[model samples]
Target: MFGIGTYPRGGRLFVAALAVACCGFGNTGTADADTFIPLPGGIITRELADGTTITIRIDEESAKVSPSLGSTPVHRNVWVSGVGSVDLAGPSADTATIKISPGYVVGCQMDISSLGVNENAGESNTLSQTAPYITPSLSESFGGGITLAPGQAVARLMLDLEKPDDYGMESHKRYNKVPGPHASVTWVDEAFEVNGCGGYAQARSFVLAEIDTTTFIGNLALWGQPFTMG
Candidate 1:
């Protein structure tokens, strides 16, 4: 469920609030129960070099965690949904373009909180915080299940753009671009599976944006609250 669209100013991206649910599953449970976790999405505002103000928001985030159909201690399954949006205001607002890339960081017995950018950091500092955890260059296809060991982590992008290159060969991109003063990307029920982690595991969502004002270029990112995958 990937879509790019224009959202009107001051409009809400998601109409309804998610109800929190309580359910648990593990290696021994019925394997049919699902736990729903509602996440507190985040927002960031940055003033670019040329006095262009860019705001990035991650909203309507939630995840459904379930025992792996494999019914093994090392397998886990999850369905995630969220919306990523960007709004530009200031000198170059009318002619700006935005590229939105939404993804997740999954860790096996590792603390992923530190891998995210500092929300309080300045524009230059935030742009410099491109650790592999935040900007993963992995070649693996995200929808395909991933395998991880303890103390290891991986980043999986939710958007995969397939297009033809200049040579007519197939190419893929992790981000979606749209002309904008305001643009958004929505994803629903995107599923990913994890395997080979016998210990505790966790996942967090993030939205990264590259903004081109036709004069100034900048980057913005927002991170969601991390949740356990049982």
Candidate 2:
């Protein structure tokens, strides 16, 4: 599993930890299916379902590592998830049905972008309509949106984690931890549609990961015997 593991001090596991992390990407400049592209700490080199090749890597100088919030250590490992993904097929809704690609997405952070064909951020086109349906089980309140009115004009979903300092906060001990690892959001074979004019628009899905596990568990490391200096 690409799942992150903990570091061990002065043991074989310590060497092993570094070994896995050194897998070093971009050798072939691609990844097989279901592979994780580490965020600022890791990189993704692959083509999306749309055949657009992208690379995701955090510059060593820009990587931020700190003790994660709500951790016992409270002094180290503030590192978090990496961010990047392929642009699974997008659809433009037109009073019928909409489609999202590369089914069964799982991640802590996802980007959903929907807007008026002629509009930029915070601005809507005349008579454009989009009603985004987020999985009720997940929090859809991560981003700001205009309140729903009778046949509202537009809906937009955005998740931009490329900026490490701007990463979203997920309370470690609050929810989705232990005996279970669940995504903050999941879009499995979903379709959307618009009800008004302005021509329904395209949707893109990107993924981001957290370095800390959602679980409160660790492996038992065996130190055997303490080394003595002669």
Candidate 3:
């Protein structure tokens, strides 16, 4: 399957919902494979797995990549599990924030809730806010926001639909079928502080929302409904 889906002003609508579900899975290339490519100002086109392709040119300068249709125009060094096809060749760009370190995925149906972390904007206010894996120093870094120090680094979280849904709070409700469909992931923090360098880092991030199944319970994965929409 696939993962990483959540939107509400977090990088190109979560990379256009992972580029409209990126062709519904085919290249199960595995080996840390993750995909999302939607470029043209609100930039986002990442394929990270060592092939090299980056253009998260969010604020400006230095953003390049190759091979979407190919004709010889390779532009390397974008590092970190690199994968390509994202452009923002200037002209007052809009968005382009990229980073795929430890992992990435959004979903392609295993009955939705493909992966998760925290925050649908509820659950005691998402565990009392303030915890995006810490990272933000030098007087709160300010440009593209991320200033790593206290160990691990991996940030790409989006998903918060209004509030009052539960799970991770607010949106994670899907159910369909038998013997399968119930996924989860959570690791908000074992320790905090980024800029001042604290220690113990573990902030899991994955939320491919869309699981309603009449509110709660367990085992869910139903499809082809003549009626039902939550």
lDDT of each: 0.66, 0.20, 0.21
How well is each residue in 67-132 modelled by candidate 2, as lDDT tens digits? Answer: 224432212211113222211111211111111111111111122122111112111111111112
Q: Which candidate number maximizes TM-score?
A: 1
- Return the TM-score for candidate 3, rounded to 2 decimals: 0.19
Taking all chains together, each candidate's TM-score versus the true structure is 0.78, 0.19, 0.19
In the range 72-165, model 3's lDDT, one tens digit per residue, is 2211111111121122222212232322211222111122222223222221211112223222211222122233443334333222214454
> Which one is best on lDDT?
1
Weakest lDDT window of 10 consecutive positions for candidate 3: 221-230
Runs in model 3 deviating more than 4 A are 1-143, 159-207, 215-230
Tell me which residue pairs clash in candidate 2: 38-42, 39-82, 66-77, 66-78, 67-76, 67-78, 68-77, 81-209, 81-210, 112-157
List the RMSD of every prediction in angstroms. 7.8, 24.0, 20.0
Error of 1 at 165 (Å): 1.4
**In each prediction, how many residue pairs overlap at the backbone (N, C-alpha, C within less than 3 A)?**
0, 10, 22
- Runs of candidate 1 with Cα error greater than 4 angstroms are 7-32, 117-141
Which pairs clash (backbone N, Cα, C closer than 3 Å) in model 1? none
